[model samples]
Target: MAGRKRNSAEDIVRKLRRADELTAAGKTQEEIAGELEVSAATLYNWRRQYDGMDTDAAKELKELREQNGKLKRLLADAELEKDALREGSEGKILSPADKRRAVDMLVTTMRVSKRLACRAVGLARSTYARTPIAQTPADPDAALRTILRDYARTHPLHGFRRAWAHLRHDQAIAVNKKKVHRLWKEEGLQVRIYHPRKRGGVSSCPQTEADAPNVVWAMDFQFDSTVDGKAVKIASMIDEHTRLSLMNIVERSIPAQRLVEEIGKTFALWGGPPLVLRMDNGPEFISSALQQFCANRVGISYIAPGTPWNNGHIESFNNRLRKECLNRNHWTSLLEARVVIEDFKDDHNHRHRHSSLGYLTPAEYAAPCTHTHQPVDGREID
Candidate 1:
């Protein structure tokens, strides 16, 4: 047989707390009884017993109830703060309309956050009800087709946003970033993968120059053979700023004596020596005699090893000389190579249209000084 139920002080306290929650929710006695797993009679009896009791007289018990209330409020406030912080981080703010749209999207997608869904629809929680929600894309296919057709030709590697930017800036096509992103996804256009560049060894002498011609010079050697099968070295000095061949000498070997003699000849012809002469780390360049000549005789500074990109002007000119002239023909003798190199040099400095000199020939680009033997600024041809 079941024992008769008795309401204890603990039971009274638990019922009182449940009653407060139920009352706040506007639930009646029947609803409270159902929620608390108690019979309607039990709920009514408990309410009658405790509802009129002096809660203050049980001060110690009341303190526990008040503490529970404070804890619940604190938890609720923390959750709100957390939600607000998340929205702020994502550049989203909630208004009345945002709340409704978020609720709707959550019902539909069941994946995205409520704040994010609201942001996607451009709704604010505070003013969502007042403002109409922005419409989603009407014709997604048309948008994708247009984006691909316009961008796929010139910028076949463009991603959605880049394609979108190009369209807006270059083609005068106007669209939102989100819409462009969607179209990009649908079209499957993306940037090509590329390997990262690795750092490499440096060249000995650095190529340095000023704004004008005759300021910086670059010297390099070309190996040639004599009729008797002996090797000869052709030392050429090129003006970095002007793209002019200041000195072109075909010698048996680049001895210190021969090199100094050639330098004096070049100085006499070209007027004055350059501020700097960029050269390689070969024996001809780094020899004690050459080093002494550069430091003491010429009073020029030398750059350290293995960096060549600094001498871009000379490098580009060398490439042109090789591709157009040297590579096109073979030399049977050193004299033949010297003759060809000299003829090519004259043509390059006098007749050839230089793109860097604004399409002007070297002679046309080089400014003629009215005074005797003065160096002139060379202009780039467009």
Candidate 2:
């Protein structure tokens, strides 16, 4: 039906053009109309119709021709554009089957093939195949902080693969495996050193003291050797209740006189002599002067021997000292080492945290300042 309408419109245009040509050749409208076998009114109508013909069918035909020309040009342009896109992606060596397989794999696994990926990324085949991806640069300070913190908290999965997984899931860092591996290696984020393995079950100190701070004191010594074959021992005393190291001193040896002096000094600084003085089975701790000082002079009872584990406070401090200070430095001289040790002790006591002491420093722990010994006679002190 549409085709028939178009054909009728074309016939009208042709007849109108012929009528115009006759009028232009000096034939009157009446003669032109009479030749066409119409009445005088119809003849005037034909002239009017011919005059108005230019406004409708002719105009519409001209517009359609212009539109048809535009559509042809646009079709040519579209073909050229397709050719350009195909040319840009044509270096792939993949067969038709391979291409289909590659596309399917990419959609399924969300991974593209080497050749197709190179094309998709607008890189040369050789360049994409050989060139390594830029590894994500991890902040060294952040990784180190994580290592130390996790080690302290005894996190089960404390190394890089686990850490990277954590970074991906918790922190939303979308890093690829190879890139993460490279950065992990470059940053030395893996756990290279392991905790010294023990044969039996780990030993823990059982709390056996009154609730107050100064009721029980634990003392121990750490030995550090000088380059000249001279050994220095650091005698440290800590309050069991508060986990506060009351005394820390580096000496040539753990002498009985020196130990006595240190115990006196600790008592002078922070009053209230401990009721029970805990000691390991070391010779320095068992010295006559140390025994006398605790027994007769200080009037403090001694905890059982051969059990340094009873001195948990000082042992914990020793672990911290080893990790934060001794492990981090290599000292040349005894005096240099002593100064460093003193500085670390001061820092630990005044600044660093004690987890068992509610993350407070030793000074903060010591601030409460009172000890009420629970009498064993089923009675409490007022």
- Give the number of the best model, judged by TM-score: 2
Kindly list the per-residue Cα lDDT of model 2 for residues 1-382, writing each as its tens digit.
4342232344545555676788899998778767755456754644554446654765676678779999998786556444433544446644333344343444345343444444443446655343233233554446544543454354332455555554554456666656666555544456555555433432243334647877777777787766676777787777777766678788776678877887888888987587667666777777787777766444343344544444556777787677667766666787888799888778667765545655466677778757576756653221
lDDT agreement of model 2 with the native: 0.61
lDDT of 1 by residue, 1-382 (tens): 9876665556666777877888898998778878877798877766665665654544555567679999998786556545544543444534444356455644365454555445544556455434332334555457556657676654453356556555555457776768777556545565564544544666443333345666667787777566577776767778765678788887667787678778878977888776666765667677777666666335343445555545556666776676566656667777887898899889778765555666455666677523222333533111
| Native-structure RMSD, model 2 | 19.5
Candidate 2 regions with alpha-carbon error over 4 angstroms? 1-207, 296-306, 369-371, 375-382
TM-score of every prediction relative to native: 0.42, 0.47
TM value for model 2: 0.47
> Residue 21 deviation, candidate 2, in Å?
64
* Model 1 lowest lDDT segment of ten: 373-382
